[model samples]
Target: MKYLMPFLGLVALLACRGKNVEGKNMGKEIVEIKKENTSQGVDTLSQEPRLKTFKGLADTTFVRLADFSDGFAFDLRYATENNFLKAKVYDCAECYTRVKTAKALIAANKDFLDKGVKIKFYDCYRPNSVQYKMWEIVPNPQYVANPDKGSIHNKGGAVDITLVDMQGNELDMGTDFDYFGKRAYHDNTDLPEEILANRKLLKETMESHGFWSIRTEWWHYNLSAASNDKVANFKWECND
Candidate 1:
């Protein structure tokens, strides 16, 4: 009986060994198949190529005045009348330049705010969509290119502005924003001296802060370091 028990144990051990060997052989076969498939460039997990997408397009880091001040009053009616579409209507809140430049301008020129030389921003922090609209309204010889192509305003690098006297009067720009006419030109001698001087001061002050004026538009100032290569679809928040 003792000898029989020993024999049975040996048989059970041998059967387990054989099953393990078979399992190892099956695993080896699977590994080899995978290797062969990979070598043949037959990727089992088929994946599509990565699509091209605009990066950081919706960066609303710029500002809107309502977020900072309850006294923020934007001329939505005037803006619409002028054909200037506001993507985020109030003011550029996240825009450091929007806030800093105004503050700096005020700091340097104390009378800027008190004297009724109030800064009226025609457009700021425009999204790519509004740019496209501008292009649709007028393309080509128009320097305001398609946002799909590239726009200075869309990059948060450009601003369209005007100034008012102490009585809250709007300056007499030769032509309004989006005026597809020769009157909008910087060298338009047809405009009055006061108008020209107003334009020049705006240009000089902005240029001092590293901004450049567009020859076609007296009120437009392009900020330095704005990426011309990248297009931003970013929308500025009116309040935040």
Candidate 2:
């Protein structure tokens, strides 16, 4: 009888050990499930859209800005008869700039995004031919740069831009784009605080990214490094 009791105790001990092992296996399974879920979440985040890099591109090469980053908003005025000329001069609406200029712009836009806004382009990389068309319309050096001299825009180094919220609504800069009066001037600070603040953000961010603004137009910015680039007349084809 004593022997039987010892054997029964051994069986009980074995049963307890088996149950402990089963509990450990269940815990391992739960851990594995959690790890798999976490991995899937990371994969989903990695699948988000990524901006293209400028590798293998030359500084002088012109590229469509939209191809590199999807974050910017565009309102190409010359393509839609909304500018001071009241004419659609471009074949279509597309923002193209030199690789170096585009890189600076993308960097500036990232800074703007951190402030809960982004750069919305009014114009970019005007062809030399388009400059002549603008000169013919205005025929005044005060309003339009002569095609013979070539504006910074013709060199793909200049852009006209404003800040806009994530919802695509433009921030007030005191004057509409292409406004030819003193209200559009950067030094004309006789304006509302909000407008000044908006312009300040745009100017500071652009300047930090190697762009300089002119006194006459708060919306215009020229990349300092691209001033020497030869004027380009290469036109982008419109996709029919």
Candidate 3:
């Protein structure tokens, strides 16, 4: 009987020890699960979208306009063969400009959005090489800028743009882009009322944003502050 009691007590001890071991293992698993949840939370925070800021960037530094704002639309005619050059000078279609120019453009676009329209870009900063290529094709000072002299476009100060409705349809400015005739002139006021009104909206809005229009082309605007900037040859990468 004594032996039987001792054996039973030993069995009870072993059972209690097994329970303790299982409890320790369960505690370890719970800690591991908590750690995994924390890691997942960090990953979720990191994946959240954060807008790029122009806080510390220099005014002359070139940046992709789309990276800073997705509100603007891009056509980038020079990237296609539809331009006056009839050749694809840019490897890809991208809108890059000086930081100051981008800031002004974003502000101007916000104002445009309030009017049920937005600015649509036909072209942005042009590399010096692309300017030379354009000069080679046309070689006309009235149409294309002399590459050696470098236009506002090569200095990241000029943008060819037009207004588009919220539906993405371009507002008529009397003539299509790259038109070199008197019909495309801003001073030619003998057009339809709607076209004149559209041009007025574009010109006033852009001028308020520190941009000035050329007398010859209604679609061209140059940032007044960027006139002294050196011409750039910065190029963008294309996706495979």
Give the alpha-carbon lDDT of every model. 0.60, 0.93, 0.93
lDDT of 3 by residue, 1-240 (tens): 988999999999999999999999999998888778777774422465567999899988999998899889889998899988889989999999999999999999999999999999999999999899888888999898999999999999999999999889999999999999999999999999999999999999999999999998999999999999998888888886
For candidate 1, the C-alpha RMSD (Å) to the true structure equals 18.3
Q: C-alpha displacement of 236 in model 1, angstroms?
A: 4.2
Ranking of predictions according to TM-score: 3, 2, 1
TM-score of every candidate relative to the true structure: 0.56, 0.80, 0.80
* Candidate 2, backbone clash total: 0
Backbone clash total for model 1 is 12
Instruction: Kindly indicate the candidate among 1 and 2 with the higher TM-score.
Output: 2
Please state the error at residue 6 of candidate 1 in Å: 99
| lDDT comparison, 1 vs 2, better candidate | 2
Error of 1 at 221 (Å): 0.8
